[model samples]
Target chain A: MNITPNEYNEMAKKASPGTKSYKTIPAAFLVGGLICTLGQLLNNVYMDAGMSKDTASTVTSITLIFAAALLTGLNLYNKIAKFAGAGTLVPITGFSNGVVSPALEFKSEGYVLGLGAKLFVIAGPVIVYGITASAVYGVILYLFKLY
Target chain B: MSQRISKDTILLTNAPSILASAAVVGKKEGEGPLARHFDIIYDDTTLGEETWEKSESKMQKSAVEKALEKANLSSSEIQLLFAGDLLNQCISSSYGLRDFDIPFYGLYGACSTMTESLGLASLFADNGLLDYGVAVTSSHFCSAERQFRLPLEYGGQRPPTSQWTVTGSGAAIVGQSGKPPYVRGVTIGKIIDMGIKDINNMGAAMAPAAHNTIKTFLQDTNTRPEDYDLILTGDLGKVGSDLLIDLLKHDQIDLSGVHQDCGKLIYDLEAQDVHAGGSGCGCCASVLCSYILKRIQEGVLHNVLVIATGALMSTTSFQQGESIPGIAHLVYLSDSKGS
Candidate 1:
């Protein structure tokens, strides 16, 4: 009845089942690889259509984002994600979902307050950190060049 | 008069009877193992409502209406109404039962609300405070997920220990006089925190509270696990149930024989992909109001101990790195009014 929190945590750890990393890791790898391969294929196709390397890369990203958004709207992304684990997560598609999901979910609250404000609820931190880290890197690069 | 047997357990002298009960669930729950037991199973999760919150309110409203209809009483006749839901501000109960105009008591015991409300209603009836009282609670999977976890469209995999929030509602009407399946006693539980920070593993957090309450109730009543036909727990799922049996074993009590969790009972775990099992206030509420109560009414189960467990933590508290506190309330229902 008076088990310490530390003691209880240890007991609970033994009691609860953990994620099957054996299965999840492979699934994540395969799915993530497939998504990246698709992006690469799109980049090649865009380049073949007379676009430059940068344009092709940008267009490929747009295409992947569009596909992810479409899948999310159709409610297929989550089902696939359940099986794929980080396969669906550590990709451009995941970022698209992070933005689109809250936008769609909070649309019930209204366009201005709900959809707009909650648009980045999940992806906001990622964007914030990404920019902050890039700014720091840029500062370091400038200092190195001056030296 | 109802006597206090111990610090937490109370022996109800005038045993209040569960006159009528009803359960209404969504599409997923209807497709689950207890599909046939539910009174009304809506093919649409929305129940023709626009939003998931509104849908949850509609389900609660339907459950209350169905229970009242089965008892052959209107909302006006019910002296007290105890209702709650797993929503902020208890919006589902307040909005759902607004038209009834009954004196309402909105409760927020999280998932334990079903038994919490039932215990209070039984105590009020036992004390001769009211001729009729209704206890009802609900939870919606979509609504709870959006509030507590993530948006429906968010592509995130749930951990193995995670539980699916049951989209359903259950209502029970307790009267001063009725047939069998009477509320013999009640044992209120204390808050038990086990320093569990994983929100996905609610069972582990709640199992200790359940174990404490069950032990307290058995001690107060001076009865063993063998005395009851069944010991039902609310939504501990597979992981928590296993831990509960193991934890009780330390006290030289074996619950493996008669213990069953509403979480495990509600779903076909292998086929349903519900991870650990079904949870939320609606999980046990719907199961008890339908399957458990029906068996009790049919004389199949003689004595039953229902301990509904709750994880008392909010998204804010969890975000603030606070441990989840668990509570479980025990309600002893028996065919005979035991002395």
Candidate 2:
């Protein structure tokens, strides 16, 4: 109960475990690859439902994002990310985690001012530039009547 | 009234000895590579407190008490207490060390509070301002998240560049004698901003400041990178550490072999999902006290330069679209000589 500082240090050093990484990379690869496979599975399911390839791919992405957001909201995504490392982070699920995490964290500041404002704190620029480039390219193609 | 060796550098002729040091960390850090070096590791983030802020306070209190306990000295022996935290207005330190009757000087240097406080403490001791000085600093991941970024429950996807705010505390006891490792010199950093506005990427923002301080310290002390066995930066994470290496490369100063960041050394990034690595006042604070100092005591290292860097930006500043400016404080610790 009244351990001296030196004794405390020795005790803690013995009780605490060092960081182990023998299986981290393989696990990350397996989990990350599995997530991608799940995405492919969803895409195939959408195509089997008679949707076009583009539509199916988009639907699959949306589905993954939705699932990831739900997990993040339930505080389950971080747990998966913790165990899976880059497996959870490298996927579209990670993107969803990025977006939903801040929104949820800022929820206490109110919906519009807090959650809504912080919604793009991390992912704002990517979405903005991504669609902007797409729109600009689309306009250029239209000008050439490539459509 | 001390000898100024160079611009922004001080020579502590009266080498202040580190009588004792201690650290307390959270569960994640408890599982880190330096886990065994820490004094206490709480499995719970809240550390049994009602809120995260209170938990961070508890960490600081415990670290100071442990350091004092280790030195076999009472709080009364410490003439001055230099403490700080990541919280706004330094509430964590003020709230935590309230019961201690020692004269307190609260500081705020974002993540670099450890070195800032230590540097100042040694300066005070060298100037005969105090016979014994105690310095401490702390940071918690949850508390920092809620204040600087988001809440714990939020599922924000961390970027490859984002660093995990370390949940820990470190306290050091400094006096004129009674210790082997001594504080030799200090180099205070000037605020450096490369106009990086992204709050998610702190490593990039703080790297320049660290680079500047290291360059200054080397030039001021007329020492080369090879002089020290370890040249550790506080918390530049993976990205910042790389940036510092690149920045140093421009000056033709190579420290590739001996350089390491506390951010990278403290965590197993590839294993732990802490994307970039750990960053915070506690990042270097806990790591230095537990792992680095322990190595010195064991004669594993001879001289070490701890350049603790900080990104001095508030959540309000980031919200207002302001760039984050960075600062660093240097502390040279040696083992072979009487410290």
* Best-matching candidate per lDDT: 1
Candidate 2 regions exceeding 4 Å error are A1-74, A77-147, B336-339
In terms of DockQ, which candidate is strongest? 1
Clashes of 2: 5
Q: Please write out the lDDT profile of model 2 over residues A59-108, one tens digit for every residue.
A: 99999999999988888988777667778877888888889888887766
What are the fnat scores of the candidates, in the order listed? 0.89, 0.23
Among all windows of 10 consecutive residues in model 2 chain A, the one with the lowest summed lDDT is A8-17
Candidate 1 docking classification: high
Each model's TM-score, in the order given?
0.98, 0.75
**Against the true structure, whose TM-score is highest?**
1
In candidate 1, stretches whose alpha carbon ends up further than 4 angstroms from where it belongs are: none
Cα error of candidate 1 at position B197, Å: 0.6
Give model 2's docking category. Answer: incorrect
Prediction 2 global C-alpha lDDT: 0.85
